[model samples]
Target: MLAGFAADLVVALHFAFILFVVAGGLLALRWPRLAWVHLPLVAWGAGIELIGWVCPLTPLENVLRRAAGQAGYAGGFIDHYLTPLIYPPGLTREHQLALGLFVTIVNVVIYGMIALRRCRLRQRSRGEVARS
Candidate 1:
């Protein structure tokens, strides 16, 4: 009941953070302030994989699930779901490093574009203002 609901909410939040990491970059183009939140998520994604650290939310969700008499998950979702395809054989040191680099690169590229776009917009606006 309550425990199940809590677990579900935790899972949803976890998924949402993943979305924020990717989408937040594009969103930052329009609202640069969002970079504050998005950048941290990028770092977190990379750091977690590099350090082989599980997100705190996973344990919280697992505890709720267990309290609800549901099964608990031992590893992070990526390790369980993506590792099969991404890692294939096993999560070797190189594979783990690659995963971290992948996340960091993807995030940087996204945010980099947003920053470029923002700079263009600002410059354009200034040019117009100068003319007026």
Candidate 2:
């Protein structure tokens, strides 16, 4: 019972991590310090997708499930659940590449916006200094 609960917890945490990797850049816009945490996560997430690496969490979850006397699943939760939802035809290497690119593009856009905003603020401050 405890093992099953642990496995479930791992699955939930894994899902949350995925969400953070996907959307964390927006959080960085509000709290710049969060970028430190989010950037590495983004890189790891993209690397996993691009390189087709199995996340360690997948095996850990499966082990827990097996210890609990439950049949372990073959793939990660994304492979079992999200892939089906997003790609009815099923997840292919092309889809994985697209997913990785999507993450990279999204983060790049968000960070670019943040940089542009900072530059504008700096320019406005300089203009005020000049006026004074």
Candidate 3:
């Protein structure tokens, strides 16, 4: 029972982490300091897709599920949980590449906006100082 609970907890955390990786830039837009934490997570998330690496959390969840007498799932967390919702069945290498590219492009656009906002703020501050 404890093992099952823990496995479920891991699944929740895994899902939350994926969300942060995909949309955490929005958080950084509000809290710029968060970008320090989010950028690394974004890199890790995209790298996993691009490199075809399994997240360690997947195996941890699987082990916990097995300990709870449940059958473990194959493939990574995204395959087990997200792919069905987002992509069609049978995720391929090309699909993985597209996912990685999607993640990168999303973050790049977000960070670009952040940079533009900062630049505008700096210019506004400079204009104020010049006028003063």
Candidate 4:
């Protein structure tokens, strides 16, 4: 029972991490310091997809599930949870590449917006200083 609960907790944490990897830049837009944390996570998440590496959490979750007498799932967390919703059957190398690219592109756009906003703010401050 405890193992099953731990497995559920891991799954929830895994899902939350994935969500943060994809959309955490929006959080950084609100709390600029969060970018320091989100940026590394973005890299790790995209790298895992790009390189076809299984996340460590997947194994941890599987082990916990097995300890709980549950059958463990095949493939990574994305394959077990997300691929069904986002992609068709049989996730291929190409699909993985696409997922990685999608993640990168999304974060690029978000960070680009952040940079533009900062630039504008800097310019505004400069203008104010010049006027003063």
Q: Estimate each model's TM-score.
A: 0.71, 0.85, 0.87, 0.87
Show where candidate 3 strays beyond 4 Å.
72-89
Which 10-residue window in model 1 sums to the lowest lDDT? Answer: 78-87
User: Candidate 1, residues 1-132: lDDT per residue as tens digits?
Assistant: 798777767776777776676467778777888889889888887787789887798788779888988774335564356324422566676776787888788778887787788799899999999999
Clashing pairs in 3: none
Candidate 4: clashing residue pairs, number:
0
The TM-score of candidate 2 is: 0.85
Per-model CA lDDT versus the true structure: 0.74, 0.83, 0.84, 0.84
| Model 2 lDDT per residue over 1-132, tens place | 898778777777787887898899999999988999999999999998899987788788889899988884445664477534433477788988898999999999999988998899999999999999
User: What is the Å distance of residue 56 in model 4 from its true position?
Assistant: 0.1
| Per-residue alpha-carbon lDDT of candidate 4 for residues 1-132, written as tens digits (9 for 90 to 100) | 898778777777887888999999999899889999999999999999899998898888889989988884445564477534433479898888888899899999999999999999999999999999
Off by over 4 Å in 4: 72-89
Q: Write the per-residue lDDT of candidate 3 for residues 32-108, one digit (tens) a residue.
A: 99999999999999998899988888888889889988884445564377534443579898988888899999999
Q: Where does candidate 4 clash, by residue pair? A: none
Sort the predicted structures by lDDT, highest score first: 3, 4, 2, 1
